[model samples]
Target: MFKKIDFSFEIKAIGYAFYFSFLPFLFFVFQFLFGEKELSFILLKQMEFLIVPFSAWWIIFLYHDYFEEGGSDLLYSYPLKAEEHGLLRIGVFSALYEILIAICCMFLIVRFPDANFFVLFIQYAAESLLYTSIGFVIILLTKKVMVPILMIVAYVSTEFLTEGSITPVFHIMSFNTEPLSLDQIIFSVLLNGCISVILFVFGHLYLRKKTDLRLF
Candidate 1:
């Protein structure tokens, strides 16, 4: 199970996640150094927020496609079980993304000091894990890359319509000045944990039942 992911795949995900996250950092530095127009800076920040989620989304799919596409055949021929394989994939990808978000949040705190960066950062990390698992579940069920992309579009569109304006991607929920009470934080983490478990279970079952299906 531990051997399911190749070093090449891990490197690719890590590299892309770090590379894309630099958008916001670069935008802030450019504005501070060159005195770019306010509107241009705001636009760059918005783009950065939108692009961050795609890093995790793309990386999850890359790992899945890299392994499940051809690696599955090799695994079946070995002694590894499907459930173990699925769990290992989930563990690695999720860890990589959590670290990616941590690095992004460090930049965010340096850029925006008015907000409770930890709370918002935690929320963003939770949501990223949830949506990433959902993305994997979609691919496990359908094996089509377009499914995840379309789902992301729908998600962002819904956020835009309901939120009225998109400031920071973390601002999808209303920004709270008061610190999140312990109960609130615990409940939120529990809720996200449940959702992640559900997605993992669904993906595991889908793969187990359709182990022979050809996927792109």
Candidate 2:
């Protein structure tokens, strides 16, 4: 399994994940040191959940681009087919980043003992999976190098537009203040899971069918 995989790219993806997870902490520190308005511990806690996974999506998109450029040619050349490659990529990239985000959440919740741990984890996990799918779709569709920049713009704009309320397409469940009922939380997870699976399947199909050597 490991022999067929591009382990170096996996390491690089984990590093990208860490970079994204670190940004919110840096922002919080800067806000605390410079700003006159005292922010609540809850707000800082919320920032960690909100920024990290979204940043992870950005990193995921970049990694997709890297792979598209034949960055990990060894995987394509090895005995592994596209499905195994996709599975390994998702596993390695998502697992490491999810753990990093989870640890960040745990540390923040330790500071604010009153926060709901399950709710926070569910929210972050849902958003991370959804954004991962979005990244997958972006990589599969656009051959242009500018797609990542456009994707970042689209993500921010969608968040701005859907700043409140839940939807099938756009919802920032991570930063929402309301404590969700069990059904709503389950629905969010299910929805994200379905989408991620669809995107992964579609991405693999795309790789198999689309034979544009110039693109991938």
Candidate 3:
């Protein structure tokens, strides 16, 4: 299972995306090395962008390899089933990201004692998994690299431009952000996690039909 994941992750684009994903965590490194412990809410909030998006890109990258590059022809003959492979790859990447987010939250507990680790974890996990699952469905459905990219751009822009009330914790986490409440976390988790699970199931079902695997 790990070997197959490694094979899928070895792509040049995924390699770069993997490294780029860590760019947000550099703040933690800077704080540790320089003892710059005054972690402002705005600075912490800025980390949200780099954290969730690249986490979603892993499976999309695999779709490029599996379908766009003619790897699906070979994959149909592999020992593992397509759905199994997709699930394992997504599971590994999502676990790694969730672990990383926990580590950062742990460090925040020390430096920023008032920080709410529980709520943050829930929010990040929900956002990450939602987008990850979105990437899975979008890539498999359209087989186009740019569709999901544009959708993500539009989604984020709408949130920022209109400052819409579309998200659960937006007001809680935005301007002069405070530690989110348990109710907000619960709602956000349910909303995003349910959608992610539904999309994941759909993608898994879609991947099962080898004959339907064609580019748009």
Candidate 4:
């Protein structure tokens, strides 16, 4: 199963994604050098907000490569089943994304030893999966890379407009300031994880029945 993955492609993708993901951290480092101590907390919060959208955008952008003219034909002609290929692609990207998140959390933890970043890491994982599933469904249904990009823009816009809402269903950025209880963490994991599973299943089933590969 692992042999099917294009490690070169995955490595390049992860490199690029991490480059963008760490931009804010780099900025914070510069600020800290300039004696802005408070930026550390801000940097942590920035990562929490950035991880989902950045990972989502990267996943959607990478999907475009598969749909390019002759690339689509060649990719679809692979010996593996479509569902297997789809799942592998998602799994690889998701795994790399989580690894990047983990690295960021580790950096923050080293700088702020008292901070409980494990909770934030768990929440980020669930949110990342949620956005990835949403992106997968959009790409599968529309077969257009731009559609997912526009969908993300609209979703982010809506999220900004409703940032004050406490309901988790309404806002992906609903992580509270206080430490989350065990029950709260479990509820969040289950809610986002279930939605991710449902969307992935729907995308896989859709791909099984899909005939057209052209984006237009």
Candidate 5:
């Protein structure tokens, strides 16, 4: 079925996602628990970074578990085609996160009427998608999750340390100091989203090639 995923995988993925999300959820919850009703720049930065890695770890785990730890033979035995399962993983998670990110955006908008809800939502989507794709591609290449996670940590740390001096239009905190016009925001979303899609497709291609290699 084009629409069905293994119920077991779904449950396990959700469980891992919860584990990955727990710390960030606590950070988010503490905002309200500590009388942080006013819009805080620190909160904005925290949300930005937290949202970036929100789904990334679980996604890496998904591929690593199925591909690396689960054994290559299991792939041939799975009900869904390899491509279908991978796409479903991305689709289901991205759709679920859209709602989650929307709720976060809504709460922030309520607290700060001046906040640009649209820009905030798009920014989070773009950044999360980009980072998740990075994790996705790297995991496929390295056949391990930790490598990509560490690589991302290093990459993001470098980006922050340099403060976008290397790539102004692409860094996560590019607009933290000076707000970007809506046009710039849209452009960044398009750029990052396009790159994410490319990496996703590239990962799929690698997966198919890998399977073919084992088959032949």
Candidate 6:
């Protein structure tokens, strides 16, 4: 299973994803260096707001190969079954994303040693998976990159326009005055994790039933 995964592809995708993810961090570093403590916090908050949308976008980018003409054919011709291949690819990408998050958190620790960033990292990771899985299902169903891209845009727009209160599930990373309770954390993880699993399973099944690469 591992042999089927293209480590080079995963690394390149992750590198691109982190390039976006680290933008806020770069601002945070600038603030820290200039002794702008207040601004650093604001930058961190902004990072939280941007992470989910960017993460979702990265997942969509990673799946672009599957939508290409010869690329889809090559993927389908692998030795493994379609569902197995898809699942392995998802697993690899998801794991790589989490690792990237962990690495970012290490850098964040240096800037805010007192913050409970471990918990925040878990929350962000769960939200990332949730958003990515939604995009994954959309791509598998429609086989068009633009559909999922638009869906992500609509979701981010709704979240921002409504201030994270309207669609709580989609805006899990939005700013909050108070710290999240243990129950809230558990709920977020469970809700997103369940939804991600269901979407992945449905996409796998849907892919298994299709014999051609035509985008519907």
Each model's lDDT: 0.56, 0.57, 0.67, 0.66, 0.69, 0.64
| Better lDDT candidate (3, 5) | 5
User: What is candidate 5's TM-score against the reference?
Assistant: 0.84
Estimated TM-score for each candidate: 0.65, 0.69, 0.79, 0.78, 0.84, 0.76
Residue-level lDDT tens digits of model 4 in 1-216: 788778777556435653575565565455445645555655545554555666666566555655643345644566767656577778877888788777666766666666567775887788788888898889767768778868776776665556645334555555454435456677777788889899989887777666345332
**How accurate locally is residue 32 in candidate 5, as Cα lDDT from 0 to 100?**
44
> Residue 3, candidate 3: how far off, in angstroms?
6.3
Model 1, span 15-133: residue lDDT tens: 55435545654554555456544443342234334534453464455545345455545445646556755667666666765665665555445545543557646666666666667
Scored by TM-score, the top model is: 5
Clashing pairs for model 4 are none
RMSD of 6: 3.6
Candidate 6 lDDT by residue in tens digits, 29-74 = 5654675554455444544555455556655656566674336764
Candidate 3 lDDT over 122-176, as tens digits, reads 7777878888898888887887767887787677666655655676454322322
Pairs in steric clash, model 1: none
lDDT of 1 at 101: 61
| lDDT (10s digit) by residue, model 5, range 6-43 | 65766574465546655776677577457545446555
Once superposed on the true structure, which residue ranges of model 1 sit more than 4 Å away at CA?
1-4, 9-52, 63-75, 114-117, 164-189, 212-216
In candidate 3, the residue pairs with backbone N, CA or C atoms under 3 Å apart (3 or more residues apart, or in different chains) clash, namely none
Q: What is the lDDT of residue 118 in candidate 6?
A: 69
For model 6, the superposed segments whose C-alpha errors exceed 4 Å read 9-35, 107-112, 165-170, 177-181, 211-216
Cα lDDT, model 4, residue 142: 72
Estimate the overall C-alpha local distance difference test score of candidate 5.
0.69
Report model 4's TM-score to 2 decimal places: 0.78
Q: Where does candidate 5 have its weakest 10-residue lDDT segment?
A: 172-181
